[model samples]
Target: MSQKIGILTSGGDSPGLNAAIRGVGKSARGAYGMEVIGFRDGFRGLVEDRTVTLGGGALSGILTLGGTILGTSRDKPHKMPVGGEVRDMTDAIVETYRRHQLDALVCLGGGGTQKNALQLHQKGLRVLTLPKTIDNDVAMTDTTFGFDTALGIATDAIDRLHSTAHSHHRIIVVEVMGHRAGWLTLGAGIAGGADVILIPEIPYSVQTVADAIQERVRSGKPFSIVAVAEGAVTRDEHTAMAAALQRRETASSKEERKKAKAWIQRLEEESTDHTLRLAHQLESLTDLEARVTILGHLQRGGTPSAADRLLSTRLGTACADLIEQGVGGVMVAARGEGVEAVPLEEVAGQKKLVPADHPWIDSARRVGTSFGD
Candidate 1:
């Protein structure tokens, strides 16, 4: 009997997910003569036995596709629902592996997917992981597949913002996606020629940001561009600002609590708020017209770039190789030119944040980009 391999895409969907799936399916079936089956909607499909045979026209022309054909979900196997009640589906997942007689399983997703894969492995399933996130926050991997595409999208948005900021002579803040890491914002900011870039790794003061804009204005450049990440926080001076909001939340009445929660949610999601709040503070302090433009969801939707397609293909192929080598509970990661399989334990819960002295960051600094510190 031919070896059977099950594959699934999980967590937030990205552009290169289909490419990775196609790579694994085509290589495993054509090269190794193995049977490839795709699990629909992540681990939920596996638990529910929702699978489809993958071969022939099913995997054709998917290298440049934007999302996974297998679908994806954020649901965890441990918390999967059974009938009408939530139940631990780990044993069910293992049972499905036995029912299908799968020799190995390929999981393609970001950090959260890797964590769940690790847990499944502990339950005795042979598994290999392919890193897939726009954030590129997964450790061990040099760069995840979808990051390049997201960077391109964010860069284009920033480039377009330049004309609007210049035309109106106002400060334009373009927010991009990056929770803890600044890879997307940093790369896009540099490519887009942002005057100031803010990231979670480096905290910034509102006054310093306002001063940077003022300095640009003083130099006859009346307009400025600020690129900020979603999770970017203000410097220590704004510690009291967040504290004041928290205090209001605590003291608010029941109806006021709902409003406070909504405001907090907006602050959490809005990269513009980070800059707008700073801009408003700057206006009060220096009187400048500051505006914010949020490039929400625009960064997440698009065709995968050539770089991302190639990277996803490489990672997918590496994952198949690892499984063939009987390597289980490992995430295939890109080091430099070569790919390495790192233990999932080392990758889960740990994030790869931007180092202060990274070469790219140094280059950004050399190019006169302020980090708003």
Candidate 2:
């Protein structure tokens, strides 16, 4: 009998999801002569046994589309809300998998999805994953598909903001999304030519940022632009987090560890309004009119860029090739101008954080970009 594969998108949606889906479905069906089906709305759909066949017509014309036709959700198979209560639904998902007799299952998503795929793999289901996130923080991969499109959108937004900042002679603080990683904010900050860029990798000082803006004002540049990552933290906050993490690591009892973990979580939750506070602080310190703009979810929408489409298609087809070769429990990672199958163990629960001494940071510094360090 011919092989059959299942596909699903999990977590937050990004721009190049459809391209990846088409690349996998078309290549699997047309090139490998295999049957392909997609689970709707991610793991919830799989638990409910909801599906859609990816035949000729369904796969056509989606290569340049923005989102997934199969839809997506952030539901986890092991901990899903069913019957008004959060319950373990892994067994139900496993039953659905067996009912469909899938030879392999492909999951397209970001960090959380990778970890979730690992759980399914441990359940003895043949599982593979693809990197898909605007954050670009997936480990063991050169880059994720949704990142390029998001970077373009963020850069364009910053470019447009420059005109208004210059006209009004004011400070504009722009927030970009990258949960606990600085790749997206750093890339867009440099590409957009922002005067000061702050990322989570480097804890920023408010006084340092104010000094940078004042220096620009002294140089006759009356307006300034600040690009900050959503996860970026003040130096004091970073220090406090480090201490809390240390406490968690050193805690002897489970109760103590749990308490430390909750403290860390609360600290992170409180930092959600950091960007707005940053604007107010800057205005007070620098005596300049400051404005804040939060690019929330705006970066996730829109069509995939040419580079993203190419990357998505490349990874998708490569996933088909691996499925044909009987590979499982791996992620189709993008290497330099090629693709590689990385073990799921190496990808799950890990993040590809931007290094302080990365070449991009050096280049940006050389071009007079201040990181507010």
Q: Which numbered prediction scores highest in lDDT against the true structure?
A: 2
Runs in model 1 deviating more than 4 A are 81-86, 237-276
User: Which candidate leads in TM-score?
Assistant: 2
Please estimate how well model 1 matches the true structure, expressed as its whole-model Cα lDDT: 0.85
Question: Mind giving the per-residue lDDT tens digits that candidate 1 earns over 42-105?
Answer: 9999989999899879999888778789999998999876789888889889999999999999
On residues 1-373, what C-alpha lDDT tens digit does candidate 2 reach at each position? 7799999999999999999999999999988899999999999999999999999999999878887899999999889999999999999988999999999999999999999999999999999999999999999999999999999999999999999999999999999998989999999999999999999999999999999999999999999999999999989999999999999999999999999999999998899899999999999999999999899899999899999999999999999999999999999999999999999999999999999899999999999998988
Model 2 misplacement above 4 A? none
Candidate 1 residue pairs in clash (backbone atoms < 3 Å): none
Question: In model 1, where is the ten-residue run with the lowest total lDDT?
Answer: 235-244
Whole-model lDDT, model 2: 0.95
Each model's lDDT comes to 0.85, 0.95
